[model samples]
Target: MSVQNRTPSWPGEQLCNSCFYTAMRTHGVCPRCGHDGVLPGRANRTDPKPVCLTCASIPEDYRCRTCAAEGQIYRGGRCARCALRDDLTALIVDGAADPATMSTIVEILCGVERPESILTWKRSPKVRSLLSSLSSGEIPLSHDGLDAVSQRTQEVSHLRSLFEHHGLLPHRDEYLARFESWLTAKLDTIAQPAIRAPVEQFATWHHLRRLRGNSTPGHASERSMLSAKQQVTASDRDDQIPHLAARHPPSHRS
Candidate 1:
């Protein structure tokens, strides 16, 4: 397939001029899948080098290489054996089954599959479990634990309506741009060092939450920390996301 998401993106404005190109050119080498794994000279995740295409596309690769590769089929790094181990660990974290028994289960899963893609992820234990779960209703899409959450159709319609109500662009692309512009304006209000919080929000949240002994929050827990020690209305959150991010700026650990 063509390079679906191999193009690079801006990690932050701090990368002025040549520094931007340099990071991409240098960091393109993916340590996991290694030289054969990355799309050399392609950019994504602000790294100009050959990179693990998926994480960078999920925009997920920006974290520590090890963590980002966890449970994932590293598109452009590592070998089959290590990727299997990573997927096994990820499945355990996602709670596919008990970690003690997962290796055997994954072995079974892998044994039944025939290779169908160059990436070899079609035979991944993680993929097998996810597919089997979906087929058998062992885990519904809405159920908890490591599911790939997607925006529902209603949610999309709601966003479109909101865009219309705001007299903003109604097209998805235009609406997205408008929303990003608004978010950028909000982030710009923050003082130095954390203005890029919007771009790095997921990684930042996970890092901070892990510090509080909360490693992985479910979708609900993630979207909002529902049961706050003190009640803060939605309005309060709207006003505070940027300011709060500034005081305790999160880092790009990878």
Candidate 2:
């Protein structure tokens, strides 16, 4: 009865987004339940020719105008994927960056499990900011470029992980990168080279090297990587010396 929070599934009825998606995902007779179909708004459950909402549609307007595919229409009579691709192309090609150079990003985002999800994510201000920088060439399309962004750590990390996952960027240990960056900043605060060098050596050799050795290439878990950072941080604070010494014997000491 309440269509305010629902989607138009039939002429006079509206379904929630999820239900609308499910209802519109297929048309014609449903293979799973052998239910005969009817026009989207012309049948009822009690009718002699009952309509299966799961496989019903408006024959004249239920398809994507661009691709002629069935499913939930996004805008311009295009499906969500088509619309997402168009929007991404527009956003990503908004600057000096060549359209050809942004094809991969567009393709990757379009190929997500649900194009609708990317469309939703694109609405975030932070996401738009990152994309704007990328489009304008302020941020190079490289790990180093993402690395140089000292602000928006969470957003950068998320986008970097997405890029790495999609093979758009070379795969590397994300946590390891964070630790190395943390170590650099941590060392810069120590004016005395004597103190800084040993701390760096201890962190790199004692914790980082071992973390790398134990890592499964680009597949290191966040917990394991964070644990390594915690170890390095603990070493810096000298809060747990015995543990550090136990791990770093004289023969293998930093």
Best by lDDT: 2
Clashes of each: 16, 0
Candidate 2 ranges with C-alpha deviation above 4 Å: 1-6, 9-18, 26-60, 94-96, 150-154, 221-224, 236-254
| lDDT, candidate 1, 1-254, per-residue tens | 22112344433323343543344334344654564333323444555445554534435343324334222223344323344545544644355434434444445433332212312543455455554563344544332212232233333333233333443322233322222334445445545443345333532354323323442321123323332212222213546667556544555332
Task: Estimate candidate 2's alpha-carbon lDDT, on a 0 to 1 scale.
Answer: 0.67
Query: Alpha carbon lDDT of residue 223, candidate 1?
Result: 28
TM-score computed on alpha carbons, candidate 2: 0.74
Name the regions of candidate 1 deviating beyond 4 angstroms.
1-77, 108-254
Best by TM-score: 2
